[model samples]
Target: MNLNGTAALVTGAGRRIGRVIALALAERGADIIVHCYQSRADAEETAGQVNRLGRRAMVLSADQRDWNAVESLCRQAWDTFGGIEVLVNSAAVYRRTPLGDIAESDWDEMLDTDLKGPFAFARFLGPRMKERGCGKIISISDTAARMIWPGYIPYCVAKAGVDAMTRGLARALAPEVQVNAIAAGTVLWPDGFDAHQQEQALGHVPLRRAGSPADIARAVCFLVEHGDYITGAVLPVDGGRHLEG
Candidate 1:
């Protein structure tokens, strides 16, 4: 759990919270395999930051929604880093789709990206971690999974599935590879939401503040390095926002 010589694969690590998690692992002396979908520039930037930390970093681009892409990503990580000691299922798609507006395509996309993608990635990468007799698998979840967010029905449902998957995988991969989830609260406003929107969102947080990417990253680090006895756990980094009605 020290992570001094471990290698990690962080999915959706190109920007936002994924980027921070990748960097935090690097700071702990772990080499990283950074995965991004469309943000090649941001992925490279994240790699640069990791390299600056004097750790090895490799950027792999893959669409998590594709099973072949997920398999290829695991292969690429092994080829680049020798082997993976940690796997972070951080790449995900979040959106707003009301129940009435949720088309089949929308449901499929969200389910594949948020739930099936993680399952595929973990299935492929799990053997290596098991073979090694040790590993860490962390998935980023959301408060929406536990609370009903009206306009994000699809997203909420997908994340709820992720939470369930995490617990199931943890039970299956126990005593060797630990599987955990971090349910993030109001970490950051979506790319275009303004200050007013941000404030409106924060009103739901019991702490009266939004959490930073670093806060989530730190929780991830704790799971990887110190949570030896923990598995099938869902830790909320939501600033007590889950309490809101």
Candidate 2:
């Protein structure tokens, strides 16, 4: 994909890693549809940045877990841009839910947001892309999807589902729309983590350091701009952390 002037939708684009990815796409000449759940202010700010970069941007709000909202968002994006050539499923909820005390609501929230959101977006937008005969869908996955994280079982399961969804969608949409995922590791330290927890997390990384949002953003750019023949791939932008035991 050339990326220039292509319409791209990035979910959870209001802040953090999602924000950087949105900006990266804008910088590369792609028009952005920035989606946020509650951070309207932040989403607007991101749109402003995209506009300043000389790319068109619009901010939209929707709860990804709501199928009706997801459908409406897809319709709105199509109505606004005429068509969407790229979709980034970056919206997710990450939290530690100890297995011993895990609640139904907790599991549902994590799975619904982290896994079902992407599934819903892809379900709604995929056929349109198929009709057009070209598109790219990039999902945000995590290293924990493939590893054991005792305190975050639900999150891990959801991400693992994301990885599966990426591969399945790739096969299903092949010869037309490309689907792929990025499995990231130790990028941004969650605000909830204490210093000791952060250190312990970092210690597992073979690179012995945390990565930046820009690192993940660059991977997204690569997939968007140059990954024409790549599909069903889970590119690990983890500074080699997935290699650790």
Candidate 3:
């Protein structure tokens, strides 16, 4: 993957880690398709940053939980950019649902957005990339999938599914499209976390520090550019937190 002048689509790219990934790709000279569900203003801002980097950019909105919307997103990206050479499935939702209070809707939302959404994107765009005989797909997974998280069963399960999807898609689309994942840990503290909670979270990491979005972005860049022989790998960008257990 040369990355230069390639077309890349990053879901949930309106903000947070996704935004960083989109900007990093654009910095490497890839045209960006910034996908968002509700953060249109943020998505537009990301597109502006990409353009300022001297790369082409387009903002597209789609509900990843909707199969039809996912399909439509692929179609629109292809229609606008001819074809996407890189697909980064970064869209996801996280919620703290304790076991006793878990609802059916909570499970559905978690699995649909975090797991099925990436699967749908890969399912639809994979064959086309296969026909072209070269492409890259990276899913954003989580370290929680590899460890037990008391109040986030649904999120953990969904990310585990993403790990499985990455391996399965790698084999299914092998010899052409490479599929991989980034299992991150404590990269960005979510809103509502108090200083004490944040400290407790960081305490588990062997590095004794939190990771930045740029850390994940750099891993994405490596997979997109230098990882020619790498596929089906779930690289951990967790600052050694996964090593704790």
Candidate 4:
């Protein structure tokens, strides 16, 4: 996919890694649609950055829990940009749902945002892109899915589902739209991680260091802009974290 002049919708692009991915795509000449739920202000800031890079930008807000949100987002993106050639599922929820005390709401939030939400976007846009001839869909998964954490069972499960869905979508959208995922490592510490926990987590990685948001962003760029022959693959951008086990 030629990112030049292409339109991409990056969900959860309000801040953090999502913001970085949005900027990276814009810098490469792709216009961005910054999606956010509570971070509308941050998303607007991201859109401004994209415009300063000489690429067009738009801000769209939607709750990932709702099924209608994806349809609305795709419809507006098509109307505004004529068509979106790329889709990035960067929005996610990472909550600690330990066993024995897990609530149903916790499971709902994690699966809805991390798994179902991204799947909805791809399912809605995959065929559209295939019809248009070519497209790319990239989701931000996590290494924890492979090495599940005791305290984040729901998060790990949702991310695992993302990997599974990535493979499924790849075959479903084959011949034109490429569907893939980036299983991120310890790029940024989750909100509640203590220093000790962070250190313990990094110890498993051979590199023994945390990766930056740009690391994942670059992987996203490679998948969308340079990965013509790649699909259904979950590329790990985790400082060798996944390789440890």
TM-scores of the candidates are 0.97, 0.98, 0.99, 0.98
| Candidate 2 lDDT over residue span 1-245, tens digit each | 98897999999999999999999999998999999999999999999999999999999999999999999989999889989999998889987799899999999999999999999999989889988989999999998889858899999999999999999999999979999999999888877788898888788888888999999999999998889899999999887888885
Q: Per-residue CA lDDT of candidate 3, range 1-245, in tens?
A: 89887999999999999999999999998999999999999999999999999999999999999999999988999889999999999999997999999999999999999999999889999989999989999998999999859899999999999999999999999989999999998988888999999999998999999999999999999999998899999999999889987
Residue lDDT tens for model 4, 1-245: 77998999999999999999999999999999999999989999999999999999999999987879878987898789989899999999887787989999999999998999998888788889999999999999998889888889999999999999999999989989899999999888878889999989889999989999999999999999899999999999898988887
The residue-by-residue lDDT of candidate 1 on 1-245, one tens digit each, is 99999999999999999999999999999999999999999999999999999999999998988999889879978977788999999888888888787899998998899999989889998777888799999999998899858898788888898899999988888779999999999887877898898888888888999899999999999999999999999999999988886
Candidate 3 shows a clash count of: 0
Ranking by lDDT: 3, 2, 4, 1
Pairs of residues at least 3 apart in sequence or in different chains that clash in candidate 4: none
Shift of residue 194 alpha carbon in model 4, Å: 2.6
| lDDT: worst 10-residue window of model 4 | 65-74
Candidate 1 RMSD computed on C-alpha atoms after optimal superposition onto the true structure: 1.1
Per-residue error (Å), model 3, residue 7: 0.3
Q: Provide the lowest-lDDT 10-residue window in model 2.
A: 186-195
Q: Which stretches of candidate 3 lie over 4 Å from their true place?
A: none
- Which candidate wins on lDDT? 3
Best by TM-score: 3
Error of 4 at 44 (Å): 0.4
Better of 1 and 3 by TM-score: 3
- What ranking emerges by TM-score with the best candidate at the front? 3, 2, 4, 1
After superposition, the stretches of candidate 1 with alpha carbons farther than 4 Å from their true spots are: none
RMSD, model 4, all Cα superposed?
0.9
